[model samples]
Target: MVFEYAPAPESRSAVDIAPSYGLFVDGEFTEAAGGRTFTTVSPSTEEVLSEVALGGAEDVDRAVRAAGRAFEKWSALPGRERAKYLFRIARILQERSRELAVLETLDNGKPIRETRDVDLPQVAAHFFYYAGWADKLEHAGFGPDPRPLGVAGQVIPWNFPLLMLAWKVAPALAAGNTVVLKPAETTPLSALFFADVCRRAGLPRGVVNIVTGAGETGAELVAHPGVAKVAFTGSTGVGRSIARSVAGTDKKLTLELGGKGANIVFDDAPVDQAVEGIVNGIFFNQGHVCCAGSRLLVQESVHDEVLDALRRRMELLRVGDPLDKNTDIGAVNSAEQLERIRSLADAGEAEGAQRWAPACELPERGYWFAPTLFTGVTQAHRIAREEVFGPVLSVLTFRTPDEAVAKANNTPYGLSAGVWTEKGSRILWMADRLRAGVVWANTFNKFDPTSPFGGYKESGFGREGGRHGLEAYLDV
Candidate 1:
């Protein structure tokens, strides 16, 4: 007889969702100039969470102007004073982390475990890490007197919304730049909530402004002449567009774009640990991560062994409501995102690759896709080449170390890559060979505020996190 586990759902009462949210400019929430709005839903239940103002070009202009007006006063403040505000924000984040986590799970459809443990902790940690840096900028090796880049425009993606906001905002603020930020339309609630945190912290008016809308709002903000710097975390296609928009302009731009990261497994790897890494690398965040290890490059000698272990592990993953603590995989962020995943998975099958998914019943009400894998995948296959941005993995085999390195680096993206082996020398060699910005040896999906994270080539440029992250917002 099978033993069934009791349901353990996190209470949504932790957060008080506002019926309607507005553009946060000049430190206050106000309706959009266009008088348009969009409804944000909880992907887990298809429940409408709230209506958010849809920002337009005029709203973006107002935000940029607000940021510009605040830049001088904010930048002139002593680093010690700036540090104090950051510390307050960090403390507030910790105090209300539970509320934010539940709200994030509701808006983004990531598992509660991740929103609580991974996303919230990182968001707070990022603020704390950068807080310390604010007072010590002169001591930082970027010469004795690096300067702030006036007003910065930032755009963050839907995946890990709060964390991405922390990543972009923390370092930018620490560097003494005022900001006009645009959170992805689908996941704007957390950012709106964060604006409240700024108010509670007594941060000065217009130091940070959040404009909620789709791509057009983001474009307007980035292209605004008042913005001295632009930082974006999104798709490569959009990154390229931002690049073009900022070309020949005075704005300093940085992009953290898409990736088809590789997780290379060798025969010498510890099977159990490697299997865990493989799962975490791809399946984490429902595989919505930009640096997610979407491609698996396994040694041909141990292919069958690794596949069997992976299949067994995949079977154990529970897929359900984001609020359920036991859920390993949650609902996709939206109907559009679910459709994208479906189309890509279909392409994987059409290209003659063998597709597999564990026997798991999905909830009929909301957007869902099972954890999937495509074997017998070649480089030419669309699934292997494109960013699926879902809980999907493409398996490819390599005969030798040289072959593994070649296959891993063949893609246009070089955001991140992982190597799993017990041998120290081989790990070092593989790390040295991979063109990715971040390399993981015998580990996957591990992140820290001190570590620099970004990509190379078509994955787009610029790093976030650590001391390196400060450079993008500062004027040397």
Candidate 2:
């Protein structure tokens, strides 16, 4: 089964990158106050890609004010007219998908295949799906004459830059709210490119604004008096801070935070099929997913066979240049993220879980970690409890469905969970008992534009996709 394959690297020429980029505010690219800038590097090779203007508190203020100005007209426009603009944006996204895919791979160190197939399509679909909801808001169960929230301050993480932007912005705009978004510092280029997409769509001047910077800019944007609603997707700690900061304010808040999701497998589960779901659950996007199935709760009876199949599959995964067409796992997003993965993994080993990884050659330069698994893991083990947020799976065995539920629900996160049993009763029974917002049967990591997704407990509150997402940007 060992077959040699030729290289199939995607061309980088599809998208052009300037030496430097400025903040996108009020339909213009403006320099940062005092000309502050930061270099964004390609994680695959640690190459300096471009210097982006660093926005400060003043820039956040500027962007929020612009969004406030645009809100009056954007909200007043008929929903059908607004839908036309959203439709235009979706069409443009489809047309430029290839270029945006290549740029995303270069900037975020994700495989071009994933960027092309998964992220870009979903980004476009969110817009198209939300556009359909624009003129039909009354039937959405939000009452007959729901109103827009005026201005939304959104902050997205780097894992899936363009898609997360689409998740927040599309629904907000469809609900007639203007937005000021801050993309993660490491992967800011694609969001900047999106600003251009907005301009080409003839979206009103201040309808969508992007400020580039680190934490300070996001803090300012969320706390700005002009911003009436706040949406954020990032680490749990940061989400907590945001909740505290906006505690007594009139601003509406929605946070999509961290998770340590569990994937449960019963003795009767289909072994090969479950193996694939398990792999996709933890290894997709190098397990940068917040709701990734990082914890595996397998029945003790079939544990050995499942682990063997999973290890063999992991061995075949190609880990190298993100531009390469066949790469399954690309580079870690940054040195910081790579170190965090390593530290948590080492803790797993030190805590006495048996660590196993497929034998593979990682690239000489760049942040890389082999697909890894840990057996002999328990609820007390760090790997089993903590959100590794990398391509690492912690395997813990359970004897019964009750034990599986207990172990899965032990964590503080209640974001997502998966069940891999063939029995219809078992899937429904477990779904009810599982404390997660999303429960998948037979498959894991399946997402749709129409499904409302959010979490309980520390995983943060509110829904992001589907009709429910409109609530975040609407004033009922």
Candidate 3:
């Protein structure tokens, strides 16, 4: 079915963005100190969305100092008081959830359905869950007495802009720490709106500072000596560099990075349910998800049958305008990301993998790529080994549970994996052997504030959601 732009299922409306973006510093939005600004374009139309301030090291220093100053008083406030602040923020997020969802879709190029139903709900839920934790730290198993880390520097990715901000900030504030956050340069609108939420929540001035720019600004924030802790979620390559950048510093760091997750289907698995899971495993969010199941390991006996079914299912996925209520997949986040995906697809064909894409017309202006698949991919193939952060998936076969385990654990990333089987014993056995941080037995890509989420190995360190999330902000 063609994706139609009907009313949002949740009845969310689009938000109007300011012509120019400003720095949210010390509780107010201000122009860049040097008046240097850059444009943010919509990936759906390839048109400039707004001009955002380009913050430099000097701006970073100012934000850090403001955060440090706020930390002195914020940390001294009782946990119950901090909990009230979080609850207020949560209420504001719900009140303006529709506006935030639309801005998220406009800026990030994800389906309005997902932004409304998935991301926005989780964004509010994260704050709600963390709010209850603010005063319960002593009972949280950290120690007899847990203290807040002074100031936290948080860097979030372009995939889930507002959701990631909520994940990083809610826990830090609940732990009684002030924050300096940097949203991805491509998708800064929702985060900017979030900064407004903080202001409306009556959070103390300088408690949260949002600086928008590219990698240079991020490096400045991560390297700032005044920050007591750092939390980052991005590419594995960049995560390694961040690890090195913070080395020898006294800052506490939590890194959440890339993944090449495996989705294993056993011969005894439910065929229709497994196929639906397979579609959602890799295609959801245009395959930009760090926990996306990019590698498909099927039981050899049913390999050909499953591949045919998967291909037929892929044909039905609607790819187009993210604002459409029916779109299953949308444009990549940016032009640069589209180019990277195209380059990797080219290399996959050159490396002898059979590539397949549904017969679909890509939009003329925006950076869009069809939902693609590569078959006969070997363990040695680059596409099978690397994290292709696009709507492209690789297919491989396994003869036994042991072989499935081996192939699943082959990559440097251990973020997440899916096991589809009817047998209870096999599910547990497979879950144990897979080295990923998250193992989805019958479900894939489910997020809850009550559940712990993170990755193992090069997928990065630190958990994001759940009670354990407080650990990142607390000095035990």
Candidate 4:
């Protein structure tokens, strides 16, 4: 006899999505300067979610100027006072988290469980954590005095819309910098909703402006003469462009870019625990995470055992509605992203790697890809070197710890890596030599507000969390 668990989806009525939205500048929602617009669709069912204003160069300039005007007064405000506003935003975020989580799932095509449990909670904690530093900046060890870097131009990607916004906005505000932020075109709703949360918290005008558009708008913001600081989180190619645009300017730039993380397992690793880590590393958020462990390096002695356990575990992962509480995998962010993942996976197969995915039926509508693994993947394989940014893992075998390090460090990205082992000495030995910014001993994809997170080389520069993150917005 077979038993099936009934589908349990979150109530959509908990959140209300507007038919249309405009650019949020100077604390007011208004039409774009050129009156252009774009449509955002729910990837789950190919349904139109909202029509939003398409911000152009003129609109970007206006938003940047507004931020510039607000910066003087905002920066002059007492640190203790700024802390109050940050604290209020944190409280309001916690109160409205459920609503925001549902909306994020709809717009971003991620499970509500992740938005609720991981993204939303961390977003609030970021604000609260930075708020505590507002009045204590002098002791943060930067110097006796540090000043805000005027208007900050921030660009965030769609994978974790609201959370990315919080990462950039909360700290900028805490450091007394006004901002003109642009959310990705596909997932702008949650950031727009965040604009309301700021208003409800009574944040000052232009203190946190959000503009919605594609690459053009972001370019204009990054190149704007009025912006003194720029923070971006997205692809590496775009980050390079922004770096060049701000080269001769006085803007302080920080970028958190792409990553191809490696999860290494030793022969002595606990089979059950390593298998779970392997799943969480590559499959979390459909593998959209920048520091996701997309490459799996297993000891040759235990390669077959790990793969067998991983395959059994993949079969148990439920992939379907983003709102379903039981769904482990959700729709890819968009047609373009899905295509990118597909193309990369195809390259893996064509390059002589063995592809394997569990026999599972995906939903009829929406963009979806099953959790997959490529065996016989070598260091030269595209799947091993490139950041697929999907629920895909490429497995490679290594005989020694030195060989594992060599394979892991071969990529241009140095964002993150994980090691699963019982011996404490081996974990430390691995951690010290790994080039990644954050190394996890027994876990992957775990984050905390108090920890500093960033990468080396092409994976981007400057950290986003902890006390170190605040320095990006300050003038030491």
Candidate 5:
């Protein structure tokens, strides 16, 4: 008999959703000048969450002007004083973490466990980590006196909305730059909620502004003359466009873009542990991660062994509502994303790859895709080469360590990779050879505030965490 879990849903009452949200500029929530609005929905239930004001070029200009105006006072404040404000923000985030997590799960459709444990904690930790750096930037190895860029224009993706906000805003503020930030169109509620946190922390008016809209609004912010710096975390296509838009200009720019990360398993790897790592690497956040290990490379000698174990593990994953604490995989963030995953998976089958997914029931009301994998994939297949950005894995096999390294670094992206082996020396050897920004020896999806995370080559440039993250915002 198959065992089933009892329904356990996290209470949505933890958060009070507003009927409508406005663009946050000059420390106030104001309606867009164009009077445009868009509805945000709960992807888990297809219920309308709220209507958010759609920012236009005018709104972007207003936000950039506000950030520029606030830069003078904000940059002149003592580092210790600036640190105090960040500390308050961190404490407030901790105090209200449950509320933020519930709201994030509702908006982003990530599992409640991830929104609560991974996203919310990282958001608060990022603030706390950067808070300490604010008072110590002078001694931070960037010379005796690192200066702040006047104003930073930032754009973050929808995958990890609030955590990405923390990644951008925390370091920018710690470096003493004011900011005009744009959260992704699909997930703007947490950013709106964070504006409330800033108000509660008594943050200076205009120090941070959120202008909400789609690509056009983000383009305006990136191209705005008042912005002294630009930080973007999104698709490589968009990142390349921003790089060109800021070309021949004085704007300091940084981008954290997409990846088709490789998770390689060797014959000597701990089979059980490697299976778990493989699952987490690709399936975490419904695989809506920029650095997700979407490609699995196994040693040909142990290919069958690892594949069998992986199939067994995939069968055990519970896929369903984001609010259910027991859910292992949740709904795709939107209908558009579901369609993308479907198209890519279909291509895998048409290209003569073997596709596999466990028997799992899906809710009818929301965007859902079963956890899927494709074997017999070649390097030239679209599924193997492209970034699906969903819960789909492409499996390949190699005969030797050198072949594995060659296959891993064959992609245009170099965001992250994983090597599963018991030999410490082999792990170091593989790590040194991989071109990725981050490499996990045995584990996967591990993150910390102190570690620097970013990509190389076409994956985009500049780091987003640790002391290195500060350099992007400073006038070093």
Candidate 6:
């Protein structure tokens, strides 16, 4: 049965774009300490989205200090009281859900259907779930009287802006810690709007501060001595830098980084369901997903049949304005990202692989790339080895389960992997051998507030969901 939700008033009329540059610090929004700002562009049309504050190292210090001061009192609050603030913030998010969705689509260029239905609802669910756990830490297996880190430094990625904010901030607050969160430089709007939501919820001043800037600002936040915890979700290279910066510090750290996951198919699997899972694993969110299943490993017997079905499905994908509910694939996050995807695709072709894309016309204004596939990709090809992070897939075949496992674990990343098989024994067998944090049997990219999601090895560490999330913010 199809589910219908209430419609919201559209935001088509051009409101005067605010001077997008400002820091949310100490219960107020203020200009950057160095009085500098930078232009933010809409990835869809390459138009100037707005000017955002370019915060400096000093600005980060100020944000951290504010969080630290707030933490002293916040940590002393009863867990039930802390949970009340989180519940209030969740309610406000639900009230302003449409506005936030539209802002996310405009800034991040994701499909409206996804931002509205998938991202926003999950964002609220995350807060609500974590809020309920606030006063129940004793039963959460964290031992008696778990303690909160004083102040948390959280940096999120561009893919799911508001949702990532909710994921990082919700649990931190629920666990009795204050946070100075930083959104990606390109997608700071939702984080700023989230600050407004916190204010409307009457959350305590300095309990959650948002400072906007690029890599330098993030480096400063991680390196600052006052921050008691650091949580980041982005590329693996940046995760390494953060790990190094926090090496000797007493702060707790959690990193959610890059992924090049495998979606394996056995001959007895249900083909139609597997096809849907494959589409969702990579193409959903325009393949900007960190846990995107870029590698398709099909058992040698049904390889041809599965590829044919996937090709037909790929042709039906709709690519257009992100605001359209019908859009299936939206623009690449930015021109830089489009170029990166294009370059890697070129490498695939140059390295003797067959490349194919659906015959679809993209809007001339936005940064768009059609859903793409490269078959005949060997392990040596750059496309097979690297994280494309776009609407691209590399197809390969394997003869045995051992070969499948070996090929799947070839990459340095161990974030996620999927298996499609009718045999229960094989499912358990593969799950045990797969060197990934999240393993899906007959499914891919499934998320739950109760499931712990993170990576292993170079993909990054520390779980983000489930009762385990409190570990990152607590003194265990």
Report the C-alpha lDDT of model 2 over 233-291, residue by residue, as the tens digit.
99999999999999999999999999999999998999989999999999999999999
Q: Taking the candidates one at a time, how many backbone clashes does each contain? A: 0, 0, 0, 0, 0, 1
TM-score of 4: 0.99
Candidate maximizing lDDT: 5
Better of 2 and 5 by lDDT: 5
- On lDDT, who's better, 1 or 6? 1
The sequence of per-residue lDDT tens digits that candidate 6 reaches over residues 350-394 is 999999998998999989999999999999999999999999999
What tens-digit string does per-residue lDDT give for candidate 1 at 225-277? 88899999999999999999999988898999999999999999999999999
Q: Candidate 5 residues 228-305, lDDT tens each?
A: 999999999999999999999999999999999999999999999999999999999999998899999999989999
lDDT per prediction?
0.94, 0.94, 0.91, 0.93, 0.95, 0.90
Residue 52 error, candidate 5, Å? 0.6
- TM-score for each predicted model, relative to the true structure: 0.99, 0.99, 0.97, 0.99, 0.99, 0.96
Candidates ranked, most accurate by lDDT first: 5, 1, 2, 4, 3, 6
Which pairs of residues clash in candidate 5, taking residues 3 or more apart in a chain or in different chains?
none
**Compared to the true structure, candidate 5 yields what TM-score?**
0.99
Residue 64 deviation, candidate 4, in Å? Answer: 1.1
23: Cα error in model 5, Å: 0.7
Cα RMSDs, all models? 0.8, 0.8, 1.8, 0.8, 0.8, 3.0
lDDT of 4 by residue, 1-476 (tens): 98776999999999999899999999999999899999999988889999999999999988988888889899999999999999999999999999999999999999988998999999999999999999888888789999988999999999999989989898899889999999998999999999999999999898888889999999999988889999999999999999999998788999899999999999999999999999999888999999999999999999999999999999889899999998889999999999999999999999999999998889999999999989999999999988999999999999999999999999999999999988999999999999999999999999888898999999999999899999999999
**What does candidate 3's lDDT look like per residue over 1-476, in tens digits?**
87554644433335778899799999989888889999888898888889999998889899999998898899999889999999999999999888988888888999988998999999999899999999999988899799998889999999999999999999999999999999999998898999889989999999999999999999999999998899999999889999999999999999999999999999999888899999999999999999999999999999988888998999888888888788899889998999999999999999999999999988898989999999989999989998899999999999999999999999999999999999999999999899999999987998899888898899988888887898988999
Off by over 4 Å in 1: none
